[model samples]
Target: MYRIGVDLGGTNIAVGIVDEKYKIIAQNSTKTKRERGAKAIVKDIALLIEDLLRKTGIKVDEICSAGIGVPGAVDTKKGVVTFSNNFDFKSTELKKMLKDTTGFDFFVANDANAAAFGEYIAGSGKGSDNFVLMTIGTGIGAGIVINGKIYTGVNGAAAEIGHTVIVKDGIPCSCGRKGCFERYASASALTSMAQNAAEENTNSELYKLCGGDIKKIEGRTVFAAIEKNDKTAGEVLDKFIEYLAVGVTNIVNALQPDVLAIGGGVSAAGDVLINPLKQRVQIEDYARFCELKTIIKAAVLSNDAGIIGAAYLDLT
Candidate 1:
């Protein structure tokens, strides 16, 4: 039988029909219109699911169950979104809402965790019992799978690796902390670093690439400058990689997952990012002496990971 997965984001609600082969056979999506409130958002999700089913000519009986991945702390056992700053959700009975609206059993999980589980079963983390996926976007988000299961702590809000401090009394973070890993290691951080470097080095390719306007500086801008053999851009990248390595080493020491997959926009640099990160982690990780090491690679599923992972939440 097929399964239904919903990726509920602040901006959009995406629904997918997953076949037995773990592929999304049909999909539908619409703006979340969250300002209309949680009830309206849930209603839209149900509508999307129905539309997908109708388009695919699949009956409700053909669906085994449905799952949702939300962007907030969730009480998975109770299907309640404990809190979500994005939607101002508080104690929202998400599971019951989906079931009442669609007449189907529903499972709920954090979106990042769902993506990691997707990779664990079908992508980079496949065949690994212990896995971790870190998506470094505007901020860094992490999901941990241990011993063949997603590890949501007692409160269902675990594996927040980004907020962990790597530099004592360093740059301030929006989370009201100093030196949080994301502040120095995320894609946003990389952009900021490149902009600042361009400002200081007027003759560098970074400055020319951004046309002397730091405001135009972006994550990809840095990579472009480095491709031009720019020294300043290279230095900025080295520092960014160093900071990222520190955070990665901390996670490796703490969890020692069998596989750690890197995702998000910056990871598109592929081996340019992964190769350096592996070299740095090799030198810094506490397990350097061990014959075996955690396999670090780029996540393969990309945007589809959340939907695929959500579809298989029943396995967790």
Candidate 2:
């Protein structure tokens, strides 16, 4: 039987059809008009699923189950999205909504958690029972997989590693907490650092890249400057890496997962980012934990992770 995966994001909704081997056989996407309201969004999801099945020439009854990954707090047991900042979904019974509309069994999971499970089963974390999938985007989000399953705590809100405190009263975070790891370790943090550096170092090429407008500087601009061996850019990256290592070290010490799969735009910096993080984790993490050193690697699925992971929610 075929399985369907739906990734609901702020900007777009992606749907994929997968076979038993976890390969995406068919996929499609459409803009998410979240401003339209929750009911409209649910309607859009229904349509997306219909479109995907039609394109794949698969009968509705041939599908085993459909899974949805939403970017917010999820009540997996109740099949509801309790809260979502990207969409106006508050205690919405997503599974029932889709099931009533399509007459198919459906499951829902937190987007990050789903992506982590996807990676664990089909991507980088393959063959490992314990690992963490960290997505470093506008904010940091983590998915914890242990013993070949997603470890959602009693309330289904576990592994919120991003909001873990890194510094006391440091940078402000969207979660209203100060010194959250995301405030310092995400792509947004790097971009903000680059902008501030550009303003201070007028002679730096980053300033030129931003057209002398600090507000226009972004993480990619900083990475480009680092590639050119710009000292100012390198400094910004070094500090960012330090904060990342601090947070990662905590993960290693706490769970000692077999691997830590890093994903998201910031991870695109490649070895320039990985090497420093490795060095710091090696130094700060417990030496006993070093014996079973967690392999730190980039996520292989990239953008496809959410869709692929959503499809495997049945295993959860």
Candidate 3:
């Protein structure tokens, strides 16, 4: 029997049909248009799933189950999204909604955890017994896998490494905490740092790259400018790397996973981010004296990780 997986996000909903081999044979996508509210989006998700089955000629009875990866604190046992700033969701009962409409057993999990599981099963962590995934996008999200199973903690919010405090009272975080790691190590933080540098110096290459529009300074902006030997961009990247190293090293020290794969939009920088991050972790990790160190690398399955991982949620 095939399995269905949905990657539900604030901007879009991606649904996929995975065969027994974990290959996605068919998929569908749609804009979430989140302003429409939870019920509307849920309707769209059910519709999209139906559309996929129709196009692929797969009957509901041939499906093993369906699962969704949400971006908030999820009550996996209850199938509810407790809260999600991105989707503006609050205690939404998603599993029952889908199950009632689609007639398939539904499962739900945090998006980050699904991605980590996907990587562990088929991507960079394929051969590892212990795996950790860190996605550096607008905010940092992490997932942990040990003994071939996800460790969601007793409360289903265990691996939230982004909210961990790294620099007491240094920067404010959306979680209403001071000095959370994401405030300094996230892609948004990198762009903010680059913006400050460009604004402080009008002649900086950063200013030219963004055409004098600081709002256009994305995470890749600094890296592109650095390729041209831009001084201000280099400075911003150096500081960003330092903050990133702190977070990565902390993850290494705490989990000691066999493979710590990196994912998300910022990971597009490839070696530009991984090489330095590796060096920083090597020097900063508490187990530097140990003979074994976690192998840090990019996640091979970019956006598909969520869908594939969700497909295997039942097994996990």
Candidate 4:
């Protein structure tokens, strides 16, 4: 039997059909266009799922169930999205809506937690019982897995490591907190830092890389500038890594997962980001004296982690 996974993001809705091997055999996606509101989004998802089944020639009865990962606090037991700043969702009955539309049983989970479970079962965290995944995109999204289970806390909102304070009274976060880790270490934050550095150092390689248009600056710009040995880019990246390490160390100190994997766009930099981050996290980890330190690595599944994790939500 197969399963279906839906990764509902503010920007896109991705649906996939997965076989027992955890591989996506067929997939479809469409713009979320969240401005149209929640119900419309649910309808679009149902259409996409039907389209995928038609294309794959798989009957609805062939699938066991469907799972959805949302970017918000979810009440898994109730199948409700308790709150989602991205979607403006409040107590939305996501599971019931999806099931009503698709005629399938559904499971709902926080997107990051779903991604972590995907990695734990099939990617970087496959061999580790205790694992954590941090997807550093616009914001830092984290998921904690302990003894082969996703730890969603009593409120199904645990492991929001990004909202944890790194600096006292520092930059403000949209989550209404000051000095949140995402403000400094997220991929968006890295772009902001690069833009600032380019503005201040007009003659730097980073400025030339973006052709003097600060708006063109992105997470990749800094890495490109670094490739040209640009001191400004190096400085910006150093600080970014420092902040990222602080967040990683904080998580490590708290849970000390066997493997702490990094995902999302910035992780595409590979060793350029992981090497330094691993170094800093190791130095700052409270259990540095321990012989078996947490291993830091990049997430192998990339974007597929969320989909695959959502597909197998029953395992959680």
Q: How many backbone clashes does candidate 1 have?
A: 0
TM-score of 2: 0.96
Residue-level lDDT tens digits of model 3 in 1-316: 9999999887789999999877889998999898887788888888988999899999988998788899888899999888887886888888888777777778999999988998898899999999999998888899999999888887677788889999998787878999999999899899889999999988988999999999999888998998999999988988988998898888888889999998998888899888988998898888889888899999889988999999889978
Question: Please, what is the TM-score per model?
Answer: 0.97, 0.96, 0.95, 0.97
Best-performing candidate as measured by lDDT: 4
Clashes by residue pair, model 3: none
Q: Predict model 1's lDDT versus the native.
A: 0.91
lDDT order, best first, reads: 4, 1, 3, 2
> TM-score of model 1 relative to the true fold?
0.97
**What is candidate 4's local distance difference test score?**
0.93
Candidate 3, overall lDDT? 0.89
Error of 2 at 211 (Å): 2.5
lDDT over C-alpha atoms for residue 156 of model 1: 79
* Stretches of candidate 4 exceeding 4 Å from the true structure: none
lDDT of 2 by residue, 1-316 (tens): 8888988888998889988998989888888888887677778778888888877789987888788888888889889888887788889898898888767777899999999988998999999989799999998999999998888777667888989999999988778899999999999999988888888999998888888889888888988988888999999999999999999989988998999999998888788988888988888978545456888988888878888888889987
User: Which candidate, 1 or 2, has the higher lDDT?
Assistant: 1
